[model samples]
Target chain A: MTGQSPIVYPGRMSRWEPQARERLVRAAVELFDEHGYDSTTVVQIAQRAGLTKSTFFRHFPDKREVLFAGQDVLCELLAGGIDAAPDEATPLSAVAAGLEAAAGNFTPELHAIGPALRAVVESNSDLREREALKHHSFADAMTLALRRRGIADPAAGLAAWLGVLAFTDAYACWIDPACDQELTALLRLKLRELRAAISSLD
Target chain B: MTGQSPIVYPGRMSRWEPQARERLVRAAVELFDEHGYDSTTVVQIAQRAGLTKSTFFRHFPDKREVLFAGQDVLCELLAGGIDAAPDEATPLSAVAAGLEAAAGNFTPELHAIGPALRAVVESNSDLREREALKHHSFADAMTLALRRRGIADPAAGLAAWLGVLAFTDAYACWIDPACDQELTALLRLKLRELRAAISSLD
Candidate 1:
């Protein structure tokens, strides 16, 4: 029987030299695209990054963690945003703000990595489950934030899940050259449409 | 690389052996519960059913498929329900009808297998991704059904996703004895609450 990996504290330490970490992620992402996800080994990724296998192990406990670099930071920012929203904003607005705050990390370089991210997510079952778990975590965090604000009949979990899906779908559409809409504007439109669609269900 | 399992054609088989199939499923479910999903093998399951490993494979391609036996059939039924729903019914209502039809497969005996099903989904990333993919397929099926019914908007995809999530959440609540609500009634309440939540976003 295969043993479950020990749980490491996520994003806790600056485990590797910054340059080495960046190189590892870049090389892994590129290799994931070129050779495919299951075929790309940790050794290959480390070698491509010009680092020893030991250094790669030092930075990431496993293969999947490399693909999800910076997720912990994103979650922390989302938590903060949800907590800091002013009294005037609706629950959905607070969630939107939190997501917007997190969106700053989707830099030009990260955006260029979109197809690779989707490919890895699509190919690996574990990656998809981890992604779903992350989404659930964000929803749980949002629910707690909403509960703190005393909003009765908490739909925070459902709302958070829907909002994330909307953002993801809209982001995918916006980034396509054929879509002809900027990401920022498209996200706003998507949010508005999602709100409307939800309203229609009522 | 592992070869894909051969697709079994139903026409080549004799008249449906419901009793044997049911016995096999019962034995598999019991084994899955006692030993956990990964630890249970085809040989053990077959012995429990008083059948052979060859017979078990003849019925199901693998262990995971045993848990997902009704998924395709349910997807088809839900898709058909959506297609046949009255034009005056709201999109939510249509989706709800489809969900009810899908959930119709949940017999009293099947409820006993809930823990094992959830365990399989939780422990295996590949299984989890396949679940997501199955949901995606059902959503696409619903979208096509809605489009044929003359729904006009970018809301088709979003609505299908939300509808499925509502069904899923309600189903989870239903199987938990601690929840103490009838599945049908709980589903109705969930859809109503979901509608209210969606409308509030406006």
Candidate 2:
């Protein structure tokens, strides 16, 4: 929760980090696929991305972060959206708004690279763990926001977990080659389905 | 999920692993508190536990594995419990049964050293990631078990995540100085409370 979070804020990405981050991720994944994950180096990724090693670290904490580049900004958007949700909104709507906010961070490049990134991630256990950590971070960010909204212990945490499931499902759809829906619409639908499924579990 | 999981099975612990594991954890935490996590060595931990270095490795995959001993066994119990739940049991009950299976791994020695282990874990980020991974592993274990029980994608994953939150809450209480209930009881109550709170979220 402390060391792992959004390294930069919203609008900060407008300052040049986003394009650099994208290049780094694309370069890192290319290196991973071509040279094997273990054989690839940050220096190589930076060289490939046409950025310095320091610039690579400036955008990503490590090489594994290549596929997970937009996470920090995504997390910040989640909390910010939740925080900015209208007064008297239910937790579900608040989370949905957060998802909508996060949807803005999903670029056409991210969507285009999704399949390849998934392939590279699925090929490695370390990358998978980092992926899990990323989802966990999203939940943590949402949980904190929900708590701030006066949602109590199990409920805030539960809603946050549900938000993560929704986010995961929506991302899965958004990445599919056949899917045409925007992430915002998919997230709202997935979250609504989660809300419905909550009652079905009993 | 593969590289980071319970290293041993249930009855497998009968053959000198549990005692060795306990000794190793106690020793490791002691060393972590005294010499700091970076300064501690596997050989030194083995020395403090009065066992060979290989014996320490036999019980744990790495130094970080020391604080998270018995996780593999707990995961097995979770899956086993879910598998053994009655044919008509609801997913909630099935998860409860899984948690009940996991409760057997919480030894008095674990309870006694809970605070120290937690303190040691809280002191470091890498260890915290390891701890988070351990919880994520538990959810993975349960999700697989629920899938075996005919539960579908988002439902299985969501149910497993709820079980984790309850397990987390129950563990928090179990580690408290004032908590006297069995982990099984605490887990059941927590899970039931989660069920009730699910509807309250909206």
Each prediction's whole-model lDDT (CA):
0.72, 0.85
Which regions of candidate 2 are displaced past 4 Å?
A: A1-18, B1-18
| Candidate 1 all-Cα RMSD | 5.7
State the lDDT of candidate 2 residue by residue for B67-165, as single tens digits: 877788899999999999999887878989999988988889889888888888888866776777788899999999999999887778888989999
- Model 1 clash pairs are none
- The top-ranked prediction according to lDDT is 2
Instruction: Tell me the tens digit of each residue's lDDT in model 1 across A43-82.
Output: 9999998887877888788777888787777777666777
State the weakest 10-residue window (summed lDDT) of model 2 chain B: B9-18
Name the DockQ score for candidate 1: 0.34
**Predicted structure with the largest TM-score when compared to the true one:** 2
Error of 2 at B189 (Å): 2.2
Q: Give Cα distance to truth, residue A155, candidate 2, Å.
A: 0.4
lDDT of 2 at B67: 83
| Candidate that would win on DockQ | 2
| Chain B TM-score (each prediction, in order) | 0.84, 0.88
Q: Per-residue lDDT for B72-154 in model 1, tens only?
A: 77778778888878779778888888777777777777676676677667777667756765666677777777777777555
